[model samples]
Target: MMMKKKSKLFVNCEEAVKICDKSQYNEAGLWDKIRLKLHLILCGGCKKYSSSNSKLTSLCSKAKLNALTHQQKEAMKKVIESESAK
Candidate 1:
């Protein structure tokens, strides 16, 4: 129907954002990417948001960040607990 076709081509800002994130992770479907690109063309705010998201993703990959190890995390937790107990 008309509604279904409209929904397929257009997306709100929130849905656009979700699709943008999924696209970044290579998880978005082709239809979703098409919808997101259409929405971004029509919505400046979403376009800006998608651009920023891409930049952040690129920066994070370049940074090559790492999370604390289990031992490090346990040590930090114990320190926090001990401090709180004092």
Candidate 2:
């Protein structure tokens, strides 16, 4: 007798968001693909979530380039100290 493999459960939008965040859906695996398709079918919320997440990620990447480093902090501290000494 041959044993049958158990199939994975199909999840809703909220679950899909968690799965997507963990990159569990990035692979070309069968279950992951089916989860994505199911999510698209039943939930507009998940669709918006996916789009917004991508947009936020891109904005964060751009903001990172404008962030201050430790050296800049030290330079600002030195200027403040000099001014206070006067």
Best-fitting candidate, scored by lDDT: 1
Per-residue lDDT tens digits of candidate 2, residues 1-86? 99966446667666688766655335445676668667767788887877787787778778886767999999999999999999
How do all models score by TM-score? 0.82, 0.49
lDDT of 1 by residue, 1-86 (tens): 36544565778899999999999999999999999999998999999999999999999999999999999999999999999999
Candidate 2 worst ten-residue window by lDDT: 20-29
Clashes of 1: 0
Candidate 1 has a TM-score of 0.82
Question: Which residue runs of candidate 1 sit more than 4 Å off their true CA positions?
Answer: 1-6, 80-86
